[model samples]
Target: MVAGPKVVHQSMPVLDVQYRCVAKGIEETVDISAAAAAVAVVTPPSSPSFRPASELDLRESDAISDVALDVNVLPFVPSIRSGSYSDIGPRRYMEDEHICIDDLSTHMGSLFKCPTPSAFYGVFDGHGGPDAAAYLRRHVMRFFFEDTDFPQSLQVDDVFLEDVENSVRKAYLLADHALADECTVNKSSGTTVLTTLVFGRLLLVANAGDCRAVLCRKGEAVDMSQDHRPIYAAERQRVVESGGFIDDGYLNGVLSVSRALGDWDLKLPRGSPSPLIAEPEFRQALLTEEDEFLIIGCDGIWDVMSSQHAVSIVRKGLRRHDDPQQCARELVMEALRLNTFDNLTVIVICFSNEQQDSSPSQQQPPVLRCCSLSAEALCNLRRWLDDDRSN
Candidate 1:
């Protein structure tokens, strides 16, 4: 079994007393005290309930032999194709940003050695302002691949997974630090991040906020990451232990999420333990034929719909059109119809070469035809009409 990444707490210096905030290209000096007092009131969404995989019934024929399940055998591999859509739903400005790279190795070229058939995707949901999210989006590749020591291994083994996890954790922390160092981003602004990395059949997800990743496995919704909110028991305990309190489901009575990148005002005095940390929780899965696609979205979508509900919609869309981009658009429109109160962003990543239309096709109704009368019948009808007219 591969061990998870070990977290180390490091203190960071608090920002200066006055914070300069940049929103929509306007710069305004914000007092830290005032910023802390003004908290956005957002209704927390219900936590997702997922059934354990063991509880799912599997047919004997679907089971793989031990020999085929071996890592060296490579029984199944995913052909990834992705598309995304975003809308500033009900919000004055869009604060969500995302990235979808279908081919990572080819994109990176000779910058660093990467496994074949690699891809990367991420969603950043910002609060307080859009600066944090925008900054991360601009520098995400550098932070993950260039700044941090990302592991270079051709093999997908337990050791490689451990190394990748460590590297990704470091990258998250590095981004957090970079946000603080950036003079343009506001100290109070922060963004929740969820990222997915795919190397051949291995899928790894690292999340630090409410943004979620859901996998469609044989038409069932499998949650790939957990939402880190103050209402969650584990997160609540951690916040309290770090000298923070949750007020009305808000962490520290200010932020909605328990973990995020940036938000220097909440995390600083440069490394005493802070309630709002940049550490990301990791989840991994070995993909198989049953795994069809993945849905990564901001809280806007999840707030209005369940994971299974989103999966069903996307599955139906794929069956009808097999267009991931259209599926993403449908998701956003559905969220709007459901009246989500925040910005919306969604990414649909398909694993199969083509849409799998498993449902039986409906037969078209038979056509009805009109028949013409014969010449003798027409003459008889004409004579009857003439006799009626004469009478």
Candidate 2:
């Protein structure tokens, strides 16, 4: 196993939590103790318990085999650097919100111990209003890390990955219920969420609705999330089976997307099997040297460009400037240029430390020019040349 911090759970009687929120191009830190407390009190759905390696019975030889296999065969852990940017686009008000934590260990502080090189990112696209997205942005830390009973382990193995995926699923469902319980948020407002987590070499992406995550490996785009639209075959089948109809491509002739959190107006009576769902689809990958970066964006970005097109833009931008922040801005600007109809949000996460030069130098060919000269100037030049020759 990779030598790193040992994972352990610790409770904090008093907590000081800080998160970065970006709104209208301005970032602010807000305290959400009340919201976090609300999340903490609500228990997550029952699932398999996440047991540490020490608790499991294993032979001494098995431990040695695991260590040898991991150290010798596993790929190197990525050095992550991420940045995000958002734009209102042509919309009157922005309904997209996002969060990026490059170092989860530092952000979470003493509440829990996380695997090395841990990071978390999420994008919430709100409809009906901005309340749902804003609410999720504020309470994301608690819902995903604290309330979900997330797994903790020093090794990134199959067991650990499975537990983490289960924890993330529970977190999504819990956040959906929490939205319904919050009195301040509108019952009709809902948001499509897409979240990505990075632990050492493992990268996990969970998505709902139209938001997408694309991984760039060796200059190629690898889609990590599928768009859950009412018109899609799988989603359409689900909606029909759930007694919901699709009219003009809208779910139940109401919402455009098939899955989302909140919208209690549709999912009313508390878990009665509605077409609209909060459950997310997951995708994961093992990071290697070929993996260059990851791009997560709202529907606005994807609606105007293909996954490969977006990856090419970001790859070119990174090579030109090696700045993830600038790459995110470029994506938003490009989407605007394409005349996207909704709010735009994008996050660019780079995996390596190597910095490329901004531009390459090239030698210019000699210029051939012809110009008219005065007779007197020409005569003087000739005389000077003659004098130099004579000397």
Candidate 3:
């Protein structure tokens, strides 16, 4: 799950829920429509729910020009709150992994002069085996704060924020390196990593592979991470340059993702670089009252749901009862109803004070995007890739 921060200054206002799965399984090619219904939203009877936006509308997501900063806009930011749960969809064992840490930034603050109590969220979707995913879940926190060149405390300056971004980049690689160096985990195992770090009003996101992070701003979905598939133009170039070829959209006829953590078996010997990698892309956003929630999930949820559909569902849920956890449950159930046959894990983080006691909607609503396949799907997808080696 990708996630929040606390405000040190005066009052401003603001807002997630969890869902758990019972069965488990590995990779599969999915049709989201078959796994979930169309994107729908529920609003107060007086206020009509908006239709789902077919595409992400991020024109104003990162700009302060869109926000009206006034006396009504309190310096007091919404407290970061998070909830999460995992499920085994159609398999025997669950390989998806996640974390939600509200005190991560705060604990790291001990190293700096000022304490910036931030939150951390991540979702790891594993392939080959669960070992790599499990390892990331256990050690991600260390890889992020200890291994990377993070500052003692966060400064609101551009340079320091850049440092934070670099640290985040290094952290992802470190985790991959640790997995490669470790003997207990499988050498062929791999996983997609999607994480979010919230410091005050700043939200930073990093991604490797297909797990995704989506933010809800004013009931609209804004993508924080893009999928790295071998078929993508730049990603295909990297794979080809690094001596990997794509066949039928699969990397070297084996891996589906162009970038990822672990999968040591896919690389060359003597530290020679392999086409597959653990490097991550990043995005930054400024939080405002209009920003409502964040969703960090593996492919299972995205397999069946659209970003706007997910946002609409959560928004409608909050509009009614304001419970992030229950909203998560509804989304998972929706996927199951539609038939997403993969291990599912979702983390929901809220930015508003909307989850207090509330009423129910006379009508119901809709659900994030990530591309993770099941183990069986991975095997089948592998059969579609063509691996040719020239040394």
Candidate 4:
């Protein structure tokens, strides 16, 4: 990989201090001290009443053939976060949400016919315009699977994690550029992205903006992504240095999110800081049979529900014999019912198996598509998935 721009390191008092907060029912919030790191509060649910995936009685139908674990995506979206606001900026009164569940996913399953009994899914919440989310729907998966070091054969090794990280970084940069290109109607628009990739027993998640990815293993809900807010230490420092100040909880007194893609209006060069970056904070987990599925969505859903509450709603729906897609749809629908005014997108990918011819020559290498093929060409075969509808 070629060395790119040097990152300006942030050194501040906030980097070393850990703050704690106590709320009545919720556990105390914890602060992270690193500028390049995350401050997260992970509170275990109070009740053992939380169902574990292993403990839940599995319906006979839940069992599938070994091949069924290959990978299949199911997802849903809501027109608006909440109905109260007839208009959210110039976008629309209804929430402008976008989501995708592509069976022909990229990144994790590029070498094989499908992901290894694992699934990949994501949700994009467009803020300035639909361009950002639309870009992720077409690009994030390719980022994860692009590294030359990515193992062609599924073997757990340190290299696996490295590849994952590198891919995420590449994806973020590529997505940012893709959205900024003049191909879109609103090239300066931006969106938040939350995605999950499940490979065999490992789950790698990444996010930007306030979009979130939550996991329910056994029955407890676990946060797998960080919310980037202006109040965040690193974000605050960047804002201040860039000559911007937070006012009323937003970056530079404007956007509510700290990091996102395609905010050209925010990425100005002569700024207190470049509009907050869209670099994603990532988490990796080793999946087990206990991991049923995952949920990825925008802030609209998170605003009205906690991770536990969201998981419970989806879990109940799954128990009622809803498929992954149906579960996702229900979550978004319920979010709208609860009065969320932002766009809502949700994706649920249940691990399934599919047949594949493993002969080395028979394997099809993955292909990536881009407007200016420079980024995509460096990695692998570039294939344009988007049309040149210059509208």
Q: Rank the candidates by lDDT, best first.
A: 1, 2, 3, 4
For 30-95, candidate 4 gives per-residue lDDT tens digits of 222331132122333345454432232323232222322324332221111111111232226433
Q: Which stretches of candidate 2 lie over 4 Å from their true place?
A: 1-74, 354-391
- Model 1 worst lDDT run, 10 consecutive residues: 1-10
Question: In model 2, how large is the Cα lDDT of residue 18?
Answer: 30
Segments of candidate 4 deviating more than 4 angstroms: 1-115, 139-151, 183-187, 241-243, 270-275, 351-391
Could you tell which candidate, 2 or 4, scores higher by lDDT?
2
Residue-wise C-alpha lDDT for candidate 2, range 310-359, written one tens digit per residue: 99999888777778999999999999999999999999999874352212
lDDT score, candidate 2: 0.81
Model 4's alpha-carbon lDDT is 0.57
User: What lDDT does candidate 2 reach at residue 1?
Assistant: 11
Q: Which scores better on lDDT, 1 or 4? A: 1
Among residues 3 or more apart in sequence or in different chains, the pairs in candidate 1 whose N, CA or C atoms overlap within 3 Å are: 10-271, 11-270, 11-271, 12-270, 12-271, 13-270
TM-score of each: 0.73, 0.72, 0.71, 0.60
Residue 82 Cα positional deviation in candidate 1, in Å, after optimal superposition: 0.3
lDDT to native, each model: 0.81, 0.81, 0.71, 0.57
